[model samples]
Target chain A: MTIVDPIIFNAFLNESKEAVESLEADLVKLESDLENKNLINSVFRSLHTIKGNASFLDLDNITTVAHEAETLLDEVRSGKRKINQTSIDLVYSVVDVLQEMLEDPEMAQAIKSVNVLKVEESKIEHIVSLVHELELLRYSMEKLPAQLEGERGDISEGLFNLELATSKASRITSELGAIVFGARLVPVNNVFRRFPRIVRELAKKLDKKIELKVLNGSAKLDKSIVEAIADPMTHLIRNAVDHGVESPENRQAKGKKQQGTITLNSFVDGNLVVIEIKDDGKGMDPDLILYQAAEKGIIFRGKENTMSDSEKLGLIFAPGFSTAEQVTDISGRGVGMDVVKSNINKLKGMVQIESTLGIGTTIQLRFPFSVVVASCLYVYIDEVCYAIPLSQMEESIHIAKGELFTQSPQRLKSGEEAMAVYSLQELLTGKFQIKQGIKELPAVRVRRKDGRLIALIVDEFSIMEEAVIHSVDSYISSIPGIQGGVIRRDGLVSIALSIDSLLETTFKKIPLAYAVNKERKHPEITDLQKLIEDAREITDGVLDFKLS
Target chain B: MRIYRRELFIFDIGGVPLALRMEDVEYILPASEITSVPKTAQFVLGLAAVRGKIMSVIDGGLRLRIQRQGTSYFVVCHVRGNTTAVLINRPLEAKNLSVKKIESSDVERILARHKLNPKMFSAAWEILKKKDSHWSETGRKFLEINTDQFVSDQMASKIIVG
Candidate 1:
C-alpha cells in the first residue's frame, strides 16, 4: 500500500468534505424530483471527484464507499435502475456514512470490516464504458475547435483585422480582469445551499412535514456579511422548525396543510439586501412574548403594558427570553433568538419581526448589499474628515450656533418636525470646550431607522462620493460613535460614523421630560402603545387559562 | 556548533537612542499624512496609510514619558499580527551584536533608572554615542525594546472616552 503524503491527504480531506456537502444538497433536490437527470448527473460528478481523489491518495476505505455510491447514481442516470424514494434514502445514508468517515478516522477503520466488496463486480465494465464515452466526447470537442478555425479561414482575409482584434481583445481581457478582481458580490446561495438539508433533518426529527422554498437564492451580497449571518440564519431556521411549526396532526385539525411551508426569499432593495424567512405555522403571539420577557426578568414588570404590539413582539429578542414551554434538545435551551439579534447588530444590520396570530410570521433581516462600498457624505469636524453613510443622511443645513444654544435641549426645526441637535465633535471627542470665534455651525441632518431625525453639528461639509469602508481594528471598533474606518480617494483613513449607534448613545443622555414630551408630541405612537397593552392583557388571560 | 548573532536596528525617539531587533522592523519611511482617531490613547498618534495598508502610528516619546519632538520618520514594525509604526526622529544603520553578551542585570538597571516596566526592555547596551555628525566616547546606555510587549500593553490598556 502506498502511504499518502500528509499534506496531500489533508488537502484531499478538505476537498472531499466540501464535495460531500454539495452532494447532500444535490440529493435533497433529487429527493423532491426523482427524474431530475441534471441533479443526478451533478451528484454523480461530485462523488466521482471525491472517489478519484481518494483513490489517488490511496485511501481504500473512502474510495470503495464513494465508488459504490457513484455507480448507483450512474445506474439511475442511465435508466438501468429506476429512481425512487428508496433510492434517495439509500444515497442519503451513503452521504451520512461518508461524512462520518471523514470526521472520524476511527469510524473509517471500523467501516473497513463491513464487507462493501460484495456489492458488485459487474459494475467495473460499466465504469470502463462510461470512461470511454467521456474520452470520445473530449476528442470531438477538441476537433470542433480545429473545425471552427477552418471555417474562420474563409472569412479571415476580407473581414478580420487580426492585429486590431488582438489588441482590442487584450485590452478587454485586462479590463475584465480588473472588474472581476474588484467585484465583491457573492451569491447568497453559498449560504442558502446548506439549509435544505438542515430543514429536512429538523423536520424529520420533529415528526413534522416541512416544505422549504428558497427564492432569489442567487441574489448577491458581500461575502463577509453572508458568512457573518450564516449562524444567525441557522438559529432562526432551527427556531422556526422547532417552535413555530406544529405537528402534522395539529395542523390537520387547524384546517391548514399538513406540510408546513417555509419560504426563504432575498431581493435587492435599493442599497440593501433584504432576506425574509416566512413560515406558514402557528404565528407568534406578541403578548406571549411580552409575558415571557417579564417572566425571564428581561423587562420590568408592567413595562409590557406600555409597549406597542410590535415592541412587545420585539421582546422575543431579549436575552434569556424563550416562549418554549418545555426544554428540548432541539431548541428550547432559551439562547437562540437573542443571539441572532446581537449577531445581526454586529454586522450593522437590522432584524424586524411581523406576525399575525393564527396566520403566519415573517422575520426580515436587511443588510447593506456591500459593506465595503458605501456612498457617504463627508463632513469635517475639528479638522478631521468623517464619512456618514448617505443612506442615513436626510439633509444638510446650516444653523446658527446661538440658535442651537437658545433652546434648553437644543432642538432644530426641519419643516414641522423638531429634531434634537448635538455637536458631533463634542459627542465623539468628549471635549466640550466653548468656541470663541464660531458663529454658524454646519449640521448634517440624519434619520435613524426608527424615523427619528437628528442634526449633527460639524465644521463643514464636503462632496458626497462612494468610498470603500475598511473595518477598524477590534479595539477601535469597540468605541462608540465610530463604525469602521474608510479609505478616501486621497488615501486617508477617515472614520465611518455609525449614525444609529451615535444617535442611540446621544439619546440615552437626554433628560426624562424631554423624551416624554417628544413621545407625547407623537400621540399616535402613544395610542398604539395603549392599544397593544390592552390587547396583551386580554391575550395574557387567555394564554393563562389555556396553560392551566 | 554555529554561534548566532542578532541584528539590531537602532533609532532615536525623543532624543534618546533605542535598539530593536532588525527582523521586527519592516521598513523605515518618511512621515506621511496621518488621520487622527478619536477616543484612543494620547500616545496613539493616529492611522497612516503605508503601501495601501493602514497602520496605527504611536508616539514613542509620549509612551515612554520623554519630551515630545516632531517626528521626521516612521519605523514600521509588525508585532503579534498587528502592524504599527513608531514615530522616530531618525533610524541608524543596522548592527550585528552577540546576543549572549547582553546581561540581564544591565537591562534591569536601565529599567529601574527610567522607571519603566522591566518587561519593556529585553537587553541593554552601553556604547559610545554619536551626536552632531561626530562620534564621541560619551558612554550612553541604550535599551532594546520588546516591540510585542509594548504593543500588547498599549492595546490592553486602551481607554475609550464616552
Candidate 2:
C-alpha cells in the first residue's frame, strides 16, 4: 500500500469518526423501532461509506470491521436476517470496535498486549458468548411470573421506568450534540493522566527525587481545549522538573525533604476552568530573574527595584529570556515559557505566575469553560463587528450623553464609585474619535481581576448572540486585544476582544489625569464646561502625538 | 544545504521588482476586501479570510516605503511562521536563477542611495544568470526580503512612527 499523506489521513479520520457517531445514534434508535426504514437506510449508508473510505486508505482493520457490520445490516435490510436483540447487540459491539480503531489508527495499542488478528477473533468470540448469555437472560425473564408478589415491586416498576427513560433521553441528547456540533466536555484527566510516568522518567534522568500529585482530575473542559492544552501542560511539567526542582542533595542540605513535590490541580471557577501547576522546590528567585532579564535586554536594567516579585517572575515568559547560566538538554534554551504562554493565549486563556523566594512557584492557567461556543455581545466599532465575550462583561448600559458627571477622564457614576469610561474606538485605535450630537452611547462595563470597573463606549450595540468562536492564527491573535476570531453565519469575520488584554495594554495607560479627575469633582456648570474643554485639548494632543 | 539555483516568486510593489522564495508563496488570489485592524501598524491592511483561515494582509508598498499603484492580486505567503497576504500590483512569474550572496557592507552604498535599509532584507542576492537585460541595464540588484524582520511589530512601529 502507498503511504498516505498525513493531512488526508487526518481529514478522513475526522469524517469517519463523525459518520460512526451518527451511525451509533441511528443504530440505537433503530433498536427501538426496528421496522423504521429510514433509520436502517441511514445506518447502511453510513456503514457503506465508512467501509469504502477505510478501504481507500488501506486501513484494513477498519475496513474489515465496517464491512462485516455492513454485511449484517445488509442482511437485515434484505429480510434475510430478522432484526433482533442479538443482531443489535452485535452491531453495537462492532460500532465500539470501529470507534476504537478510529481513535487509535494502525492498531498501535488499542487492544493492549495482543496482536490485531488475535484481538479481533477474541472480540468476536466474546461478543458471541455475551449474546448467548443475553438470550439466556431473556429466556429466564420470560419464564417468570407476569405479576410480582410484592406491592413495592409494582411501584418500583414505574419509578424504574421513569429513571431509565430519563437516562436514555439524556444519553441520546448528548450523543446528538456530539454528532452535530463536535464539541464535548471532557475531563482534564485525559491530559493529566499522561504526566505521572513522564515526571518519573524525567526526574530519574535528572538525578532528582520528585513526586507529582494531580488533584481534581475530573475537572472538565472542552475537548478541543483539552487537546490543545496537552503540549503546554507537558512543557510546564518538564520545566518544573528541570528548572523548578533542585537536586535531592541540595534539598536535604536546605533542610527540606529529599523528594520534591509537583502538584497539578484543576478546578472550575464559575465560568472559568483553571489549572495550576505548583512545584515545591527551591522557589524562583525574583532578584535573580530580574538580573538575568536585564542582562539579556528583556527588561530595563535599572527598573528592577521598582517591580514586584510577581512582575519580576513574569519576565520568564519573555521570548528568548532564560535565567539559566548553562544550557541543558531538557530546557533553558529559552523557548518553553513563551511558547507555553502563547499557547495558553491561543486557547482564549491567561497565565498567571506567583512565586516565593524560598517556597515554591505556582503557574495558573485559566480558560473559559466552553471555548467552542460562547455567548457574546456583538458591537460595531468603525463599521466592523467585534464580539465581546459575555463572561467578561459585567453589564451593558446606555449612557445618556448629558448624564456625564465628569468629563476630564470620562467617568460614569454608578452608585458609590465612579467607573472610568473610555471610547472603545479610542481604546482600539489609540486615537480619540469625536462623535458629535449623539443622544445616548452604548457602553459595556467590565471588571478587572482586581475588581476595578472600566466601561467601554462603543459605536453601536447589536443583539447578544451565542457565537461560535474559533481561534485565529497566533500572528493575528498576538495583537494586544484580539483573543480570537468568529465568523458569522453570513460569512463576516468578527474579532473577539480579550478584555483582560485590552485593560492591560490600553486602559492601564490612560494617563495620570484619570486619578486627578477622579479625586476632584466639577459640580458647577462652568467648571464642568472648562473640564470638558481641557479634556478635548488633552485628547487632541494625545491623538496628534499618536497619529504623527 | 547548497543548491545551484533558487526558485523565486517575483512580484512588483511600486514598479520596483522584488522576489521571495517560491516555497514561501502559498498561493496568489485576486484582491479581495480586506478589513482594517485598529491599533496596528498602518502597513497592516488588516485581516482577511482566505479559504476559511484568518490571514493578516500586509500592504507591501507601505511596508517597503514605496508608492504602489493599483493592486491586482494578494500573494498569500508564510511570513514569520504565520500566513500573511501581501498586496502587490501583479505577480510576474516563478523563475529559477543562480544567485550569489552579496555582503551587506558591499551593498550599503547602493542601498543607502535608494533609501533602503539593509536589515529589512535577509541577504542581497546578485543574480548571476540574469535572463532579462532590463534589471542589469538599470543596475537593480535582487534582494530577498527577511519576512521575520520586515513584518515584525517593532520594525513596523519604527518605520511608521518615525
Candidate 3:
C-alpha cells in the first residue's frame, strides 16, 4: 500500500523494524532455553509478529514462510514436540530469511520467484500444515510451570535488518532513537543499596559518621542519554562521597548529629533534567581559589586579597585553576570540577557551584529534558546559514561606531581588532572558499559567559530550523568565515557559522593585553603612556583630568 | 525557462571606487555610523551600523590603489563570506556592459605612440594610434598613443639618443 504521510509511515516502519530486530536476538537466546517451554512462547510471539508485518506490507512470499514458523512455535508451546538444537537452528534460519526478504531487494525477489503463489491463501495454507506436525509432537513432551516474562529487547539496539530497508537507509537511522521507550518506572533498590557502603567508608576515614540519601531511583531516562551521563554522574557522586560527607568524631565535637548528611536528588522539570549534589561537610573556601588564581598569574597578585566571593568562585574554571594542594586517590587535583563543567557544556548543559565556607556546598548541573529537539540561533556567513543552540549562547548586543572602544588597549575587550561591528558580507569572504569579490558586511555582537564578547560578521541571515546537520566533505576546505555548509529547504547549500571558530579568530585579533596608543588617545591614555614613554611633557598634557 | 547570470558590479568603498564581480558582493545597505577598531590595516576603518545591523567598513580605493573623493560615500562587498563596506573617493555609476573577455582573453597587440603602464590602467590615459594592419587615420592615431608598448618604446629610444 502507498503511504502518503511520511510521519505515520516512518513510525510504522520504525516500530515493525524494532520488532523484527528483537525477534532475531530472542531467537539466538532461545538455543539455551530450549528445554524451558516458556522460552518457546516468545519464539511464537516473534514469528507471529513477522507474519503480521509481512501481510501489512503485502509481501505474500515472506508472510508464507513466517506463518509456517509461527505454526511450529505454536505447536512447541503446546508441548507436542521436544525442544531441540536442530529445531532452533531451522527456526533461526527462517527468521533470518524473513528478515532478508524485508530488508534486501534481491532476496525478496528470490523468495517470490521460488514460491509459485505469493498471496494470503498460499501463506495461510503453509502455516496450517506446519502447525499440524508441531501439535502432534507437543503432546508427547513433559509438563512445565508458567510465569510472567520481562520485556525482552531494548529499542536502542540496532542488530538485525528486520525493520527499515528503504532506499534511503541513512535517512532512517537515528542516534537518539529508542525502540520501546520506557513509559513507567520499575522499582529497583539501587539508591538504598549504595548509601550504607558510602556512609560506612567515609566515616572511617574522616572520623565522622555520614548519612547518604539518594532520591528518585525510580525515575527513568532514555537509555542513550542516561548511558552518556552515567560516568560523569558517577564522578559527581564520588566527589560527594570523598568531599561532601564528613567523618563521625568531628560531628560530635561540633555538637551536631554524629552523622553528617550528603544528598543526591535527581528529578525532572519540564524539558530539563537536573542532578544536584549537596553536602554538609567542610564547605569550600573561596580564599583558596582566589589565592591559587593569583599564584598562577590568572589574576593580579593583590587582587585575590580583595576579590569578591563570586569572582573567586568564577576562577574555579580557569586553567591551572586548582587550589587543592595534595594529590589523592579521590578528586584532590582540583581539575575535577573544571572537567565536569566542560563535559556538561558539551551536552549543552550548565554547571554551577554554590558554597558557604564552614556551612555547606552544592554543585548543580542542568540538562535539557530531551536534547533531540534543540533551540538554536540561526545565523549566516558566506551565504550559508547555521544553527547555534541557544543553550550555548550568552547574549547579543550592538556597539555603535566609535562608541566601541578598546577595553585595555589596541583591541576592544570583545577581542576583535577590527571594530566589533561587521556585516554579514565581510565575514563570508574570510571563509576563503567562495573566491568571490567583496560584498556587504553584517556583524552581530555575541557575549560569552567568560565576560568575553565577539562580533560575528557574515554575509546573510536566516532563522530557519535545520532538521539534519551534514558536514561538507574535506575535498572542500572549510571557509574561514563560514563554519561549514549544509543543505537548506530549497536544495541550495548554505554556509553555517562555526561559533567557536569565529570566537577563536576574534580573540586572536584582539587580545586584551594589547593597548592602542594613537597619537591622540583621548588626552588621558596618551598622557598616561607619555608619563611612561617620555616624562617631561606629561605635566602640561594633563588638563584637569576628571576626579569624578 | 529563463536563466540569469550574475553580472559584475563596482561600488564606492568609503569614497574610493573599485570594480568587483556582482556574485562576490551579497547586498548593499546605507552607511550611517562606523565604529573604529584598532590594530587593523590602513584601509580598514572599523565596524559600522548599516540598516539595523552592524558592518565592517573598508577603504576600497586605498586597498586597490584607486582614487577616492569623499569619506561619506561607501560601497559594501563580500569576499569569502566576510562582508566589508569599502570606502571610496566617489561613487561610480554602475555599467552593465557586455565585455568580450574576462581579463584573460582580451589582450590585443596594435601599433601605438605612447606606452603607458597597463598595471596603472585605473588612471586615465590618452590614445595616439590604431592598428595599421587594418586601420583608419583616427583609429591609427588613437591606438599609437594608447598602446603601452608604443609609449615605453619611445621613452627607451629617447634615453638612448640622449
Candidate 4:
C-alpha cells in the first residue's frame, strides 16, 4: 500500500483515535439505554468514517475491521437485532479489536484465527472451563452454610455479614473506578530514556568525555505534564552538554576530573516534582552574562551595574541574549533558553538557576506533579472565592482590625521579620474597600519562591480541599497575579491565585528600603519614603530598583 | 447572474446592535462565573470556561467605547486559532442579510464620522434604505469588525500596573 503524507496521516490518526474514544464513551452510556437511536446512529457514523478513511488511505486491515463493526452497528440501527447483554459483550469485544488495530493495523489480518481475535472458539472454551471451576468452588463454599447452622443458626447474622461485605466491595470498586478515570501517571523515564543517547552523541561530537546520570527515573507524573516538559527538558540537557561542560583539557587545567559529570536528579517534594540538573564543569561568570546582555541590547547599558550577581545570571533567559563568544550549530543561537523558559511557563512550572563561578551550575525545574489535582485553600474576599495552592501557603493568622492600622508603618510582623501587607480584595478587583463592620480579618501568610513572606489580608478563610485546576487562556495567564481558574466542588469557578506573582508585584511597588530591610526589626518608614523619592529624582524615573 | 447573501450573527452590546460573520462564531454560551484578571485592559472582563476550554472574555461594550455594564450572554468567537468570548447583552440572532458592498468614499465617511480606527474594520455591508423606518438614509451600513485585529489591539493596550 502506498503511504500517505506523514502530516496527513498523523492528522487522520489523531482524528480516528478521538472518534474511537468518543465511541467507547458513548457505548458505555448505551449499555444503560440501548434503544437510544441517536447514540446508535452516532456510533455507526464514527465506525463508517473510520472505514472510509482507512480505505481512502489503502489500509485494508483497518478498513476490514471497521467495515465489520459498521455492519454490526447497522443491524442494531435497523432494529433487526435486539440489544442484550450478549450483544453488549460482543460490541465491547469489537471495541477491543479496534483498539488493537489502532496500535498495530496489521493485526487486523488475523481476523480469521479464533485465538488471534481472542473472542471466538478459544474464548468460549475458556469461559466454559472457568464456569466448571466456579461450580466446584461454589460446592465447597456450600459447607459454610452448614457450619453457620451448627454454630448459631442465626440467619440475620449471616445476612448482615453479607451486607457488610457488599458495601466494602462497592467502596473498593468505586475507588478503583476513580483511579482509572482520573489523571494518568506516567514514568519519568519516558522522557529520560532518550537522554543517554543524546549526551553520548553530543559528547563525542564535542570531543569531551562526559558521564550522564539519571536518578529517580521511575518517578511517575501526569501524562500531559510529562509530554509538556519533554522538549524543555531536552533543551536543558543539550545546553548542559554544549554550553555547560567544558573541554577535557580545560577541565583538567581547572583541577577537575577529565570526564565531566552531569546528573539529572528528580524527586517528589510535597506536591511538586523537583528536577535538578547539575554539571561538574566550568560554571558561569555573572559579569560575562551581564556584559553580553548589554551588548545584545537586551538590558540597558549601565543597568548591569545595578544588578546583583544572581540577577545578572538571570539575564541568560532574556530573548536573544547569549554569553557564548561564537555561534555554533548545537547552541549559542540565543534562541533556546528563552523558549525553554516560555515552554516551562506554559506548563505552569518554574525554573531556577544556581551557579558558582568555578564550582558548577545547578539548574532546578519545579513542576506540580499532577496539574489536574491540587490541594487548594479557599479564601473569601469581598464575597469572591479565591484558591491558593497549598504548596505555596505558609499559614493563616487572624489579625485584629485595630492592629492593622495601629502600627507606625502598616506591616505584618511574623517573628522578627516584618513584611508589607496588602489586601487581597484590592489586588484582585482593584477595590480597596474592606467589608463594613468587620472586626478581625483573616490573613494568609504566603511565601514566595525566593523565601520572602507576605501576608495577604482577606475577609475570612474557607475550607481547604483538593480540586482539579483548569488553566486559563494565554491572554489571561499573561496578566500578573492571576494564575488560572479552578472549578470548586460547588460547581463555581474560583480564581487560583499565584502567590509568587502577587509578591513580586507587591515587592516592586514598595520602596527599596522596605524590601531590602525586610529582615530588620524596624526600618524607618519615613526615611525609606524619602530615600525612594531621592532615588527616583536621581534616576529620573528611568531606573527600577528590584530584588532579584 | 448569482445573488450572494451573507449570514451574520447579530446581537446587542450596550444597546447598539452589532453583527459578526457566522463562520467565526463557535457557539453562544450563557455568561457564568468570570474570574477577574488583574493588570489587564478595562475591556477584559476576565476568563470564563466555555465548553471545557478557558477563554478570555472581553466586554464588547467597553471595546466599542460604550458604558461598562454586565452582560448576560457570551458569544464565543474563534479567530486566528484563538478562542475568545465576547460578552453580549442578549441572545444572538442569525440573519441572512442581503447587503451590497460599500464604496470607498462611503467607507471613509463612516470611518471619519464614527472616529473608528481604520484597521479595526475590514468591510461594510450596505443596508437598502427603507421608508418610514429608523434607518432611512441611502448609505446606512453596519461595519464588519476584524476580530483578530480587535483582539490583538485589546491585548496590546493592557496596562501593566505594578
> Could you say which candidate leads in DockQ?
1
Worst 10 residues of 1 chain A by lDDT: A539-548
lDDT of each: 0.69, 0.69, 0.46, 0.66
In candidate 1, how many Å is residue B42 off? Answer: 1.1
Q: Which candidate should be chosen as best, given lDDT against the real structure?
A: 2
Off by over 4 Å in 4: A1-182, A185-281, A284-371, A401-420, A426-431, A511-548, B1-5, B67-71, B95-97, B103-119, B127-141, B152-162
Q: Model 1, B1-162: lDDT tens per residue?
A: 122356888887666668888888898877777889888878778777655555678877777766656657888896555567888788866778543323578666656666766566676665544469654444555777877654556575542211
TM-score of chain B of 1: 0.72
Cα RMSD of all models vs. native, in order, equals 19.6, 22.3, 26.5, 22.3
Error of model 1, residue A465, in angstroms: 0.7
TM-score for chain B considered on its own, for each of the candidates: 0.72, 0.75, 0.50, 0.70
lDDT of 2 by residue, A374-465 (tens): 57999988678998988778888776544454444344354445566677777777655444445565788787767877778887888787
- Judge the docking of candidate 4 as incorrect, acceptable, medium or high: incorrect
Residue A405's lDDT in candidate 1: 27
In candidate 4, what are the lDDT values of residues A79-115, reduced to their tens digit? 7888776876676677677767776744223232222
Provide the lDDT at A141 for model 3. Answer: 22
Provide DockQ values for all models, in the order shown: 0.24, 0.09, 0.01, 0.15
Q: Could you give candidate 1's per-residue lDDT for residues A186-301 as a string of tens digits?
A: 56777777788899999999999998888667555666677677899998888889888888999999999999988898754433467889998899888888887887788899
TM-score of each: 0.49, 0.49, 0.29, 0.50
Clashing pairs in 4: none
Residue pairs with backbone overlap in model 2? none
lDDT of 2 at B122: 68
Once fitted onto the true fold, the runs of candidate 2 whose alpha carbons sit more than 4 angstroms away are A1-274, A277-353, A357-361, A365-372, A407-417, A472-478, A489-492, A506-548, B1-4, B95-115, B122-143, B153-162
